[model samples]
Target: MMPLIADLRNPAMRDRHWKQLMEEVNKQFDPHADSFTLELVLDLGLEHHQEAIAALSQAAAKELSIEEALSKIENLWETLPLDLAEYKGDYLKLRSVDDVYSALEDNAVALSTMKASRYAVAFLSTLDTWERALSHISETVEMLMNVQRKWMYLESIFVGSEDIRKQLPTESSIFDAVNAAYCKTMRELQDAGTAYKGTMAEGVLDGLNTMDEKLDKIQKSLDEYLETKRQAFPRFYFLSNDDLLEILGQARDPLAVQPHVRKCFEGIKSLEMKEVGKEGRKVHEAVGLNTPDKEQVPLASSVICAGAVEAWLLGIENAMCTTMAQLLFKCYADMKKTKRERWIKEWAGQLSLCSGQVAWTVECTKALHAMSEGQKTAMRQARKKQTTLLTKLCDMVRGNLGALDRKKVVNILTVEVHSRDTLDRMVKANCASVNDFEWLLQLRFYWEAGTDRCLVRQTNTT
Candidate 1:
C-alpha cells in the first residue's frame, strides 16, 4: 500500500497507478474470499480517485460551454460590416462564468446589429404599445412584399424594351405613382419601426390594395402591347421575351442582334457585321457559307474591333444628344420667362376661387336672416334643401383648399423656384447639357428596371 501510494503521488503516472491500486483493494475485499482484519485499513485510495474524476468532469464541461459561447460570438461578429471592424479589438476572451457573461455584455451591439430587424421587433414586444406596433410592422411588411413581388413580375415587361419604354409613357407614369406610394409607405414603416409609432392600419392596407390593382392594370396593358409587337414581327416569337426585348431595345447596336440571328434564320450560324467607315454605319449582309457539299460566295468583307464600335456609337449618341439639347435649351429659355407669370396667375385664380366661396357663404347667411316670418315658413322648406347642397359644396371646397395648402404652390413656384433658379444661373448659367437630355431617354426606366440588371437576374432566378 505504501509503494502504491508513492506511485500515485507521481503526477505523470497518477491515473494508471490510481486505477491499479483501486483494482488491488477491490480484489482483496471480494465477498467469497473475505477475511476480517483485526485493525481496519479504511482504504481512502478509491475515494481520492472518484473525487478527482468528478472534479475533472465538471471543469471539462465548463470549458466546453465557454468554447461554445465563444464560437457563437465569433459567428455573430463576422456578420457585421467591415466598417465596424474596430469592434473586434473590444471582444473579451475570458473563460470563467462571470467572464462569459461580461463577454456577452460587451458584444451586445454586435448581437443586436447582426439581426437588426428581428431585434427591433423583439425589443418592441416588451413595450406597452407592442400590440399596435406589431400590427403596423406586420402590415408594412405585407405591403412592401406585395409591392416588390408585383413590381418584379410587371417590371419584366418594360425592363429591356426600348420600344415599350418610348411608346408607353403611361407605364412610366403608372410606375412613378406606384413608386411614390411605395416610398411613402417605406418612410412611414421606418418611422414606425424606430419610434414604435403607429399609422392607421386601414391606410397601409388600402395602399397595398391600390398598388396591387395598379400592377394588375400594368400587367394587362403590357401583355397586349407585347403580343401586338410579336404578331407584327413573327421572328420576335422565336426569341424569349427577354432576348427579344434586348434585340429590339438595342436596335442601333448591330452586334447585339448577332446572337439571335441563327434562331431567326435557319442554317445561319451568325450574321457577319462590318463597320463601313469611322461614322459607325454598320452594314450587315448574309454571306453564303463555304460548305464542303456546296459552292459559296462572299458579299462584304470589313472588320472592326468592339472598342472602335463602341466609340463610334458614343460619337453618334453625342451628336444626336447635342442637337436635342440645343432645341430643349431654347424652348426652356423661352418658357422660363413666361412660367413664373403663368404660375402666379394660376395660383392667384385658386385664391380667388377660395375667397368667392367665403363670400357666397356670407351671402347665403345674410339671405337666411333677412327672411320675414310669413316668408320664413316657405323659406324653411327651401333652406333645408339648400343646407344639404351647401354641406356637399363646403366639403368639396375644403378638400380643394387642403390639397392646395399641402402643395404650397405659391411658396414653391413664386418663392422657392425663382430664388433657386436665380442662384443656380448666378453660379452656372441656366443651360442644358447633353447629360441632361440623356436622362430623357432613360426616364422610362428611371425606377431602376433598365440599369439594374440584378432585378432581371432575380426574376430569372425566381
Candidate 2:
C-alpha cells in the first residue's frame, strides 16, 4: 500500500499532473453523490495531505459506497502514519462502521430471502431440518451461540486488543438478522400453511420459539459483553464461581446473586470453553429422551449473562414474556435498534450537517422521491433517531463493559440468592406430613442471592 502511494508521489505530478490525477479520481463516484468529489477532499484536506485523511474519513462517513472506500482509505492510512499500529487501532474503531454496513447487507439478504421463500433455498431449508433430529434444539443452538460468541470475542482479544486507550469497536450483528428472519419465517410458514404441509409434532413450535428466544437472548448478551470487554478482558465468560469470588476478594451474600435466584453454570472451565456442538446433542438424548419416538430437552445448560437487557430494562426480558407476540415485538424492537445503529454509524461522516450539531436531519429529496410519504417519513425518522439511539447504545455498551472489566480486575461479582427452603424443608413442611421424599416433580431449586461484583471461583453442587 505504501509502495503504491510512493510510486504515485512525484514532483512532476504535483503541478499539472495533480490536476489530471484529481479529475480521474473524482470521476469514480456517482454524479448524484454530493459527498464524493476530488475538489471536496482538497477543500477538507486544506492543502496538507494529512488533512486529506480527515477529509477522506469524513467523506467515508457519508458515502453509501462505504465498504469499498474504507478499504481504499485503509491502504491510504497505512502510508501516512508514524505509529502505524495505533493508526490501525483507530482504523479499527472506524471499522465498526463497516460492521453496521455489513449487517444492513445481511438483513437485506435475509429479508429478500424471506420474501422469496429462500429458507426453501436448499442450504437454509436443510439447516432447518437439521434443527430437528438433534436431540436438544435449545442446547444445540446454545452451543452454536457459544461457538459464534467465542469466535467474535477472540477477534476482539487477539486482532484488536492492542491498546486500551484506543477503543476498537467490535462488530455485533447476529440477532437482528436471526430475529428478523425468524419472525418472517414464522409468518411465511404459517400463511403458507397447507401450501407447504408438514405436521409439526406437539411442542415442536414451542421448542422452536424457545430456541429463537434463546438465540435472541444470546445476541443481546454478546453485544453487551463485547462492549464491556472493550474496557476489560471478557473474563466473565469463562470464570468459575470460586475464581469469581477470589477476584472480588469476598463472596457476595448468598442472598444477592442476580436477576435469577440462583446462578448454576454447568459449562466452562478456566478461560477455555469447548464447543458443545455434537456433544450437546448427546447430552440432550441422554438426559432428555424417554420414549421410542419422542425427543427430549436438556436438564442442564449454561445461563448466559443478560447484561444488555439488564442494563437497559434493569432486568431480564424473559420475565416480560406474557405472550409470544409481546416477545416478538421486543425482538423486533431490538432488531430495529441494531439495524438503525449500523446505518447511522456507517453514513454519519457523509451526511453534511450544520457543523456544531451532534445530530440534525438533511433531507435527501432525490433519495426519497421514489418512496411513498409514509415510507419516506419513516426512513427519514429512522435515520435521525438511529443516529441518536446508536450513540446511547454505544454508551450503554461501554458502561457495562467498563463495569465488567473493573469487576474482573477487582475480582468480585454480585449475584443474589433466593428465599425458598432447600432439600426437604419446603417438601415436608410446605407440602404435607406424608413425606418430602414422596414427590414426582420437585422442579424448583434455584433460590439464592443475586447481583454485584464477586470473584471468580470453583463450582459447587446445589
Candidate 3:
C-alpha cells in the first residue's frame, strides 16, 4: 500500500490509475451512501507520503521567498539612483554574457553597482525562483496587453457607431467594466513608471485573471445575441462571427453585404441595391438567383438598418414561401383535370419542399417581427392558409392513389415484399417520398374494382 501510494505521487501514474483507485475504494465503501470523493482518497494517500509533503512545503516556501524579495526590490528601487534606473531596463533585457558586456559599455557605472546589489545577489542565489517569477509576470503582462488591445478595438467600434450601440445594449455594462479595469491597470503601471514593481506585478496578475473572466462573459453575451439573430433567420448561422459583425457594423451601407448575399440566401448570387427617397435610405429590392439563364427576381424592398437586416432577409424568405405556396396550389388545381402518374409524382415532390419552406418561414417571421402584435396576427393567418394548402395537396394525392389502374393495384398487393421494400417500390413508382407513401399506408381499408381489402395487410374483406 505504501509503494502504491508513492507511485501515485507521479501525476502521469495518478491519472492512469485514477479509475482503478475509484473501483478499489468502491469495494470497501458505498460511493452513493458514504459520498466518497476522489479528493478524499487522494488526501488519504498523500498523508502517508511524507516525502511528497516535504517537497510541496519547500516549493511553497520558495514562492514566499521570491515574493518577499520582489517586494523589497520595489521599495529599494525608490532610493536607487536615476542611473540605476537606466540599467534596470537594459539589464532585464540581458540574455547572455555577451549582452551583459554590451549593456555595461552603455551604462558602466550603474551596471557595476547593479551587479553588486543585494537584490542582484539574491536573484543569482535563487535562479530557479527568479526564472519562474519572471516568466509568470511576463505571461501576465502579455495577457494584459492582449485584453487592452481587444477592448480598444471593440470600444472604438461601439463609440463610433451609434446604431451598433443601440442595437446591442446588453454589451454596454460589460464593455464598461473592461474599460475601467484596463484604464485602472494602465494608470497604475504608468504611475509606477516601471513594470517590475511588486505592487504592479501582483495587481496586473490579478487583473489578467479578471480580464479572462470578463472576456468569457462578453463571448457568451455575443453568442446569445448572434444566436437570437440566427433563430430569426437561420441562414445567418452559415456566416462566421467576423462576417456577421462586418454586416451588422456596416448595416447602413447596402453594398457592404453584397459579397455575402450568396452565402445567406441559397439561390441568390447578389442583390440589386440602390438609394431612394429624400432620406437617401439604401435598400435591397431584388435578388439575382444564379439560374442557367441568370434571370433576376424582384423582392419587396426593405430599408437596411443595424437591427432591421434580419427582418429584411426574412421578408425575402416570406416572399419565396408565398411563391412556392402558389405554385403548389397550381399543381393541385392541374391534378384535378389530369391524374397522370407523372403529374402526381411532380406534385408530391413540390408539396414536400413547399411545406418545409412555408413552415420554416412562418416560424422565422414570427420571431423576426416579434415586437409587432399586428405582424404576429398576420403571420398566424398566413400560416393557416399555407397549412390548408398543404392538407389539400396531400388529400388530392391520396385520392388519386385510390383511383390507380386496376392492374397496377393488383401487381402491388400480390408481390412478396417487406414493408420497407414495399414503401421503396411505391415511392419509385409514384415519384413520391417514403413519407408520402407512409401517410397513404395508414389507411386500414381500400376499395378497388368493386373489391374491399386491408391494403397493408394484403387480406380480403367482404
Candidate 4:
C-alpha cells in the first residue's frame, strides 16, 4: 500500500475545532462522563452524516430524509424483484426495459469512482465501522488468488473457437435446420396425439401419427450424430508447436529454470591465451547460469500460465489420454474455491430456467389448441407475466440507486410488503449490474424454446 497525502491521526492541526463541537453536543444532552468518548464520536459521525447529505442534492438522495435513512427504508415491497415466485410475463418486460438502462448507467458511475464509498470528516471524532480489519491474512490470500485468476482468464483468450469446435461437428450450418425440424415434428406429433387421442390412423388423423413417429426418429438420429462429432474432436488447433514457446508459454510437466542473484568474479585473462579458454568456461557459469542457489518462482504468476496450459491440454488429452487423467479435472481444481461455489449457484439458477421453459412450452401448445376467447386470454397472460415482472423489477431497482443508503434499502427489503412473493426477493437482491439482472431473467427463459431451461433441467434430474 502507498502512503496517503495526510496522516489520519494528526491531531494538532484540527484539535481545537473537534473539542468545540463535542462541547456543543454535550450541552444539548446531559452527557455522561466516562462515555464522553462515545458521545464525542457520535458528534463526529453526525457531522459526517450532515456533510454528506448537504453535499448531495435532494434529487440525488432520491427524496430520502435523514430520519428515513436512519430508521426506515423506502420500498415498493419487501419482495425482491427477481425472487418473486411468480409473475405475469408481459408485465415484467413492460416494467423492466427502462430500469435496465438506468441501472447500467449507475454501474458505470461505480466503476469510475476514484474514492471508496465511505468518507471521513475533518472534525470526525467517530467510530469507523470498517469491516475486514481483523482478517488481513485472509484478504491478502484473496488478493493473491484474484491476481492469479485474472492472468489465467487472459491466457484463456488465447484459446480460439476453432480449438473448441474440434470436439463439435465440423458443419455448424446443419445444426439450425436440424433443430427446427425436430421442434416442428415434435409439435405436429403432440398436436396430432391431442386431436386423435393416441397414434390412431383413420380419416383426418390417418397417417399423421405415422409421420410424427418417423420425424421423431429423424430427430433422434441427428442427436446421435451430434454425439459422434463430440467423440471425434481433435487434440489441438492449427497453431505451430513452438507457438507456446515463442509466447513464453509454460512447458508441460517440465522443470522450471530458477534465476539466482549471484556476484560474478571480476577478472581479466583474455590476452593470456593460456587461461582464455578456462576463463570463458568459468565466466559462463559465473553469469548466474546453472547456479547452485536458485529462488523458487512466485506461484501466483506461475499458476496462471499453468492454468492456461492445462485448459488447452485438456483439449489435447481428450484426443489422446491413455492414463485417463483428464486435464480439466486438475485445471478446475486450481480455480478459486468460490468459482466452484458459483457453479453450484448456477444450478439453482438453472432450475428456474427449466421450469420457465415447461410453462412456455405448455402455453404455446395451449395457444395452438385453444378454440375460444377465454382460454386464449389465460394462456397468453401466463406467457406474458414473467416478462412484465422482469421489466418492472429492472426499472424499480435502477430508480433506487443512490436514492437511499444501502443499509436502509436492505432493511426495507427485509420488511417491505410485496404484491407477490416471487418478486420480493428479486427486489431485495439489489441489481448490481444490468448483466446480473439480464442473467436472472435469462435463467428462466431460453430464447428459442420460449420455455424455461431451469424447469427442463429439473425434470431431467428427476
Candidate 5:
C-alpha cells in the first residue's frame, strides 16, 4: 500500500505500478479459476483504481481552491461566489475522497460481476454529467459577472459627475434640473433596453421603471408647486372670471366690437410685458446673468421660475383672445346705437338748413337774378359752402355706419321718423327746388341702403 501510494505520487512510477498490477492480475486470473475468486480480484483492483483517481481529484481540487483564495485576495473574482454549490448534489456530489470512495465502493462491488462493457458505459455516463455540470458553472459565473457590471453601470449613472448628481432629485426639490435629468436618463434607459436584449434587458427595464417612479414623484411635487404659484399670483397666472363675464354680458355685435376689445388687449399686453420684465430682471440678478458663460451655465431654479411665468403669460394671452372676442361683440352693439342716434340728429339739422336755402332760392329766384354781380357772387359762395358742409356731413355719417346691416338701418330710421308717411312728407317739404329735391332724395336713399357714390353724384350735380 505504501509503495502504491509512493508510486502514485510520481508520473512514471505510477504508470509502471499500474502496468505491473495489471500483469499480476492477468497472471493470477485464469479461465480455469472459480467465478467468485475472479470476481473478488476484479473488485479489489477496481477499488484501488477508484482510490487513485480520488486522490488525484483531491489534489486538483486543493490546488484550484488555493488559486481561488489568492484570486479572492486580489479581488479578481469579486462577484463570483466562493462556494462549490454549482458542483454539489447529483453531479460530483461528494467533496472528499473518503466519501466518494465509500459511495463508489458500494456501487463498484455490485458492478464487479458485471461485464466490462457495462462498467465502461457507467463511467462515461458519470463523466458526461460532470462535463455538463462544469458547463453550467461557467455560464452561471459569466451571468453573475454581467449582472454585477450592469449594477455598477446603473449606479454610476446617478452619481457619475457633480452636474449629473445635482440633476437628481433631493428631498427638498425636484424642479428644472432634476426634471431635465430624469427625462434624459429615461430616454437613455429606453435605448439601452432596445440595445441589450434578454438578461441585460431585464436589468435595464428594472432601472427604467425605478427612474420612472422617481420622476413621477418629482412631477407630482412640481405640479403642486406650480399650483401654489398660480394661486399666489392670480393676475399673472390667468384672466379673472368676473372680468370675462362682464365682457361677455356687454358684447352685442361681434363684428363692430373688436376695436374696443383690441384696445383692452393692448393694455393687458403692456401690463404683462412690464411684469415679465420686472420678474426676469430679479431672476437675472439672483442667478448672476451677467456672467460670460451665462448661456452655458444652467440656472436651474431661475429657469424653472421663468418657465412658470412664461407658461402663465401664454395662458393669459389665450384667455384674452377668447374673452375679447366676446367683449368686442358687446362694444360693437353699444357704439352702433350711440353713433346712429348722433348721426340722425346731425343729419336732421343739416337737412333743415339745406331745405331753408332751397326754399329761399325758389321764393326769390328773380330777386337773386336781379341783384348786382358782387351780391350774386356772395350768394353763390354761401350755397357752395352749404353744399360742401352737407357733403362732409354725409361722408362722416357713412364712415360711422361701418358694416351696419341695411335692415338695422331701416329699423332705426323707421323708429326715428315715427312713420313711413311722416318720413315721405319730410322728404317732400325739404325739397324746395328741382336740384334740392334730387339732393334730398339722394340723402334718403343714402340713409336707407345707398352707398357714398349716391351722395357723390348729388353733390356733383349741384
Candidate 6:
C-alpha cells in the first residue's frame, strides 16, 4: 500500500526500481534459485547493446574520411612559394660585368684631369655600386635555396600523409568516392612541386653562377688598378726634385712631362724646410738652377696642384674600398643570421602543425577503441546482474509456477526490467572515459611546450 519510493517513469531511475521489485519478488516466493534461466534473459539485452556499439564504431570511422584528410594536406601545400616567374624576373635584374666595365670606362674619362690619388678615389667609389649589385645577387640566391628546401620538405609531408589516407579502409561508398577525388588533387600538387624544383635549378641557380663569374672578373680588374696606383703615387712623394726636373726636361714622352714637373714641385713644397734644412737647400738649388726664368715657378705650382689632385684621389679611393668591404661583410653576416632565425621559426611552425594533425587522428582512433571496450565491459556487468536477479526470481516462483509459466514470467520480467533504448543511451554517454580525454590533453600540452623549447634553443644558438 506504500507509495513507490523510486520513479519508474524516469529513464535514469527505472533500472534501480526494476531491480528492487525483482528482489522483493524473490524474497516473497523463493530464496534459493539456480541462475541458468537468468543468464538466458540477460543475453537478449547484450545483443541490443552490441548493435549500438556497431553504429558508434561506424560513426567514428566516418569522422576520418578522405575529404578531411585532403583538406589538411592542401592547406600545407598552399603555404609554399612557387612563383617561378617572380624569381626569374628578379634574377634578370642583377647587373652584369659588361655593365660594370662600361661604368669604369666612363669614370676613367672623368678622372683623367685629376692626379693619381684623385683617380684612385674616384675609381674606388665606383666599385661601391658593383658591390651592392653583387650582394643583392648573393641574397637572392640564398632566399631561393631556402624556398626550395622548404618546398621539398612540405612536399614529402603531403606525399606521406596521402599514402596514409589511401591505406585507411573504405568504410562506405561515400569514402570511396571522396578518396578518388582526393587522389587526383594530390597528384596535381605533387606535379607542381616537382616543376618548382626544376624551375629553381634552371633559372635561379644558373643566374647566380653567371653573376659570380662576372663579379670575379670585375674584382680582378679593380685589384690591378689599385696596384698600379699604389706604385705610381709613391714616386711623386719620394722622387728628388732634380731627378723629376731632368725627366721633365728630357720629356721623350710629351704626355708624361707635365706629370713629372708636377711631381717635382710637389716634392719641393712638401719639404719640412725647418725640420731638414739640408733637403730644403737641395730642393731650393734644383728650382733655382733649373728656373732660368722666374715665370717657371708658377709652372711648378701647377705641378703641385696635380700632386694635390693625386693625393685627393687616393685618399677617397682607399676610404671607399674600406667602407665597401666592411659594408659587404656586414651584409653577409646579417643575411646569414636572418636566414637561420627564419628557418627555425618557419620549420618549427610547420612541424607543429604536421605533428598536431597526426596526433589528433591517433587520439581519435584510440578514443574509439576505448569507447568500444568500455561498452563491452558495461554490457558484461549488466548481464551478470540480470542473471543474479533471474536466479532469485526462479527460486521464488518454483512451487507456484509450472515450467512453461515460469519461462513466460521470466521473459515478461526481463522485458520490463531492461529498456533497450535506455541501455543504448547509457552506453553511448559513458563509453568515452574522462581519464582518456585528460591524458590526450596533457600530451598535446607537452608537444606544444617541447616545440617552443626547441625554437628557443635554436634561436639562442644562432
lDDT of each: 0.43, 0.31, 0.49, 0.29, 0.35, 0.35
Q: List the residue pairs that clash in candidate 6.
A: 29-396, 30-396, 117-310, 117-313, 117-314, 118-313, 121-317, 262-303
Q: Kindly list the per-residue Cα lDDT of model 3 for residues 233-349, writing each as its tens digit.
A: 899998997788777777766677778878887656666555544555434454423322243444333434334777776776676565544555555446557644444444434
| Predicted candidate 4 versus true structure: per-residue lDDT over 1-462, tens digit per residue | 011112212222233333443454443332234554545645545444444223332222232222232122112111112111111221111122233234333433432331232332321221121111112222322332332233223223222233322333332223334334433433443444321121121221223333344434433543454344333422222222233222223232212111101111111111110111354342111111121212111111111113233342343233223211222222223322433223222222222223334444344334334413335344334335645644543444455443223332333233222222333333344322323442234323222324211232222232
Candidate number that wins on lDDT, 5 or 6: 5
Candidate 4: regions farther than 4 A off: 1-249, 253-359, 366-374, 396-462
Considering TM-score, which of the candidate structures 3 and 5 is the better prediction for this target? 3
lDDT tens string, model 2, 290-404?
1111212222322232222223111122222222223233333343355533422222111111110111111222213323333434334434544454355444344534432
**TM-score of every model versus the real structure:** 0.32, 0.14, 0.42, 0.18, 0.21, 0.18
TM-score of candidate 3 against the unseen true structure:
0.42
The positional error of residue 45 in candidate 1, measured at the CA in angstroms, is 66
lDDT of 5 by residue, 1-462 (tens): 444344333432233344444564443333223652535645557445646544543444443443343334224212322222122122111122233234334434423332233223324554344334334434433443333333333333333333323433461243333334434543443343321122133343344445445545654553454455446544423443333223222222222222223233332212211122554354211121111211111122231123333243334445444433333333333434555345433332223233333333332333233333234343344344444544544454455453333233444433333322332343345433334443334332121123211121244443
Q: lDDT tens string, model 1, 23-46?
A: 644533322223422122334344
Model 4 TM-score, all chains together: 0.18
Cα lDDT tens digits, model 6, 1-462, are 011111212223223333443453332211134532434424433233433334333333333232243344334324433333222232111112343234334434433422233223423443444344334434544543443343333223323344322322232223334224333332332454532232233344454344344334433443453345446555444455334333323323223333344353432222211121365342111111112112111111111112323453344334434433343333333434554223222222223233322333344335446566665464435434445544654554554654544444455345424433323344455545424432233222112233232121111231
Candidates 2 and 5: which is better by TM-score? Answer: 5
Clashes of each: 0, 61, 0, 56, 6, 8
The better-scoring model by TM-score among 1 and 5 is: 1
For model 2 the local lDDT of residue 249 reads 24
lDDT for model 6: 0.35
- lDDT, candidate 4, equals 0.29
